[model samples]
Target: IDVDKSVDLTNCDREPIHLLGHTQGFGCFIALRFDWIIAYSSANTNDYFGADSDDVIASPLKNWIDPQTLHDIRSAYQASTITGRNERLFSRAIEATGVPVDISIHHNGTFIIIEFEKITDDRVPEDSFVRSMLSQFHRYSDSQELINSTAQYIQFLTGYDRVMVYQFLPDGAGEVIAEAKNENIDSFFGLRYPASDIPKQARALYLKNLLRVIHDVDSEPVPILPEAEDAEDSIDLSFSTLRAVSPIHIEYLKNMGVKASMSVSLIINGKLWGLIACHHYSPLIPSYFVRTELELFAEVFSLELSSRLMREREDESNRVRNVHNQVMASIGSEGSLLGLLEKQFDTMRALIQCDGIGAVIDEDYRTAGTALSADWVHQLTRYLNRQASSEVITVDSLEKVLKNYDTSSDKIAGVLAIPVSKSPRDYLLFFRMAQTQTVNWAGNPEKPVSFGPNGSRLIPRSSFALWQQTHDDRCEHWSDVDVRSGDSLRVTLLEVIIRHFQERSELQS
Candidate 1:
């Protein structure tokens, strides 16, 4: 891919970032073949190794480092190969410059890539400090409390201008659910950003690489010498610690008045769930050790979050199940499904979290909570029956699904239809009232594209002002637990309907 080619929002996702053939200036990279011979080196290798690319390329690894350092590299290489991950050697002395540096070694299929960054901050957090942070996390069982505490702890540790827990919504947009920022800076809490801000390819890379750091967005990238004639065949830097930043992304950060940034992926069940995004207003290059610690923190946080969500789901399921058992017991004692539901309508509504509940049994319609006209309930039942599926049907926006219906007056925006019988198409429908709310966006999301430096390509918006948008004609989305409860209720009601018919037939005979 041509890095300098003009691109618009439509084609930006096709950018080949892994084949950029460069590294950040803060660190130097070297790729060694299987025989320990250097195959590729960053153009700025002489700055650290005191050897030009011409002299280092094709040379044995022993030519640059002392024998002891060479032995250590080999050991780290072996460990990386065994673990299938990058191995780190911190605070190692470079014999040529006599400077202490941190080394990261990894095997990229055909070559061993080694990255070096000079040691700047040698300070390590005390064990007690780490324990204290973990203990803070342990004190919060609520998801929001945990998320907010994470932002606070990260900002406290890194001293960034701002740290946000940005969660991905269903529409691919991101929302800043929690934030910690310096007193002088404006808050970005509760603000949303369009999906274009982080394109699809960028999200895929974040999933593969758990952490990314942009030390200095304005610094020039050091090109890799002997750049592959064909960009597709360039050395893959997918896992490099010092991979060059995409030009467009640099422009994005600059527009936001940021000089440095770091993002830690929060993955759940092998999916990209959210991000821990940190921004610095000035150039800041954290030591590799500190970055590594942050990576560990993100991993531990993801696990705890996944476990907490699963436990909450289980508790909700248990509560719904208890309500369902009560409803079933009442039906058995009354020997009439309609009689039991009409008498204990509120209890039936508790089977799921919804604003109202309605049931349609052979020519009879019963409703509780929010009132719905019998004609409208019958019309919705006919609409659902046409689908010809026995499974639960959930719709968050009734207008989107039912085109000609006048749903604005009813103010019921969501529906969960559980099919109880196939012949008559009896349904137990859960309805939710429409809600109107304001969304705070970091900028006008619709105007994301603007002329770039060349005026030919589309770049990110140049502003970060708060833009508010009012959203209506929708209700609270039905969660996975709600759907599951609906399905469970569907199955139980089907069994009851079948037995009732069987007993009626026997009595008539």
Candidate 2:
């Protein structure tokens, strides 16, 4: 007797007789043999199977045969014991509803939400419950070293070539505040990108979609429409992942030799903060499971990072305000304005990450505490004497266009010169460099630049020189935008400095 248990099983049965057991399979002639079986949860048939009385259904398939079918079934069955059980469960729900779509997740700060909608492609609204939990975790964070540490942690977690704290600028430009990059790639530690790199439309799309996966830039195209349906036209790129990259953009990445890029947009305070951009040189594909895990971890990291940044900004603001107040008071007390400014260098140096601090004042362009050796200063004197020097102007100029300006043959690696108030008044300036230590300007630093027992300056050579040659358009030999008022730290410092001076002026009057 053959047993067939399909939708129409009754039609396949030839003769039906004897006593029957509901689930234990005890039919008369085939008493000990079980052919036609209906098991709800296996435990319901435990009597004949000799299963322990307390045993529950361990699996839906209880020792069934047919090797190929068993292998296929097991392959499709993802145990709920895994980390993404919730996503898998959601996938099942969608599958049950007969939807042919795939799901993706978008994350920002402490909030995590499904990138799906009941009737549309938009992401779900923020979950208040998730936000509350995130806030508590942030409160427990160790904020002092959080920015740098988190950058490192997230890079490790996501396996990205580089992880950066990208802050958006007012005119649509973006700048890197902090970074963790691979061994071969140089730091863009303080690099800037035009607002055009990420167009307005791309940003809008990013707002709607939290994450984008570019598995392989060189992957074979999955035809958007059947080749039979339309053989003449190319696919629209806006929504299709398979669309070919625009020619200009492809050439741009090729020029830089960036093979793959994965970017996660980070939103903080309901605004676009920047992104955690991951770069891979070789062709790579991250599995769905890996992507899901990475996103969860990345969300946690981004939240911590945003919280730390905001708090630091606030703290810096208060500190600067206090220092400025003191400066104003000192200016009125018993010292020259230049002297008072000199006294403030300690605080300014600490705040601006500068090794040296100086300014060009009035007609003579007087110098204060030299950040470099006196020998280098003499070389700089020539450039400083020019009636119209880029040293005084805010825009790009002669002082900024060259890579190694100091006639000492030692290049002035970085400088921040700003005309704070202009005219006869003092112009605040700041400078910083990894002394005797060549910066990993063009390629990633596998080893830290070695320095002698006594601190000096790093000699820029090889890749550093090569980088200056190639990126001369963007490189500034002495001037850096890090001191720009728009920087979070600079903004806080200026406010504090201004407030202090205002109070001091009143005290003297």
Per-model TM-score on C-alpha atoms: 0.80, 0.47
lDDT of the structure predicted as candidate 2: 0.42
Please, what is the whole-model Cα lDDT of each candidate in the order they appear? Answer: 0.79, 0.42
| Least well predicted 10-residue stretch by lDDT in candidate 1 | 462-471
Spell out the clash pairs found in candidate 1.
none
lDDT by residue for model 1 (1-509), tens: 12223344546577788889999999889999999999999999888788899998999888778788889999999999998778888878778777677899999888899999987654564343455667777789688889998899889888889999999977676889999999998888988776677888888988988898999998999999888988798898888999998888888888889999999999999989999999999988677877887887888899888989888878877887787677666554325667655665676677776778888888698888774568777777777888989999988777776766545687677789898877788778898876433346566445544567735545565222211121346666777767888898877777766666676677779
Candidate with top lDDT is 1
Residue-by-residue lDDT tens digits, candidate 2, 1-509: 11111212122121111001111111000001022121122122232233422332232332422354334323333331133222311221122233322232221122121221122234242222333334445445555355565567657655778777676765555677778889888777876664445556567655544555554455432221112233223222232222233333333344455666666677766666777666666654343334445555556666776777777777776766675566445544344445655676666666555546764434223344445444444444444434343233322222353435542243344445544432333345554442224323333334333322212222211123323333333223332334433243344434544665676787779
Residue 272 shift from truth in candidate 1, angstroms: 2.9
Candidate 2 residue spans exceeding 4 A from truth: 1-136, 139-207, 226-261, 269-272, 279-304, 329-335, 351-356, 359-440, 443-509
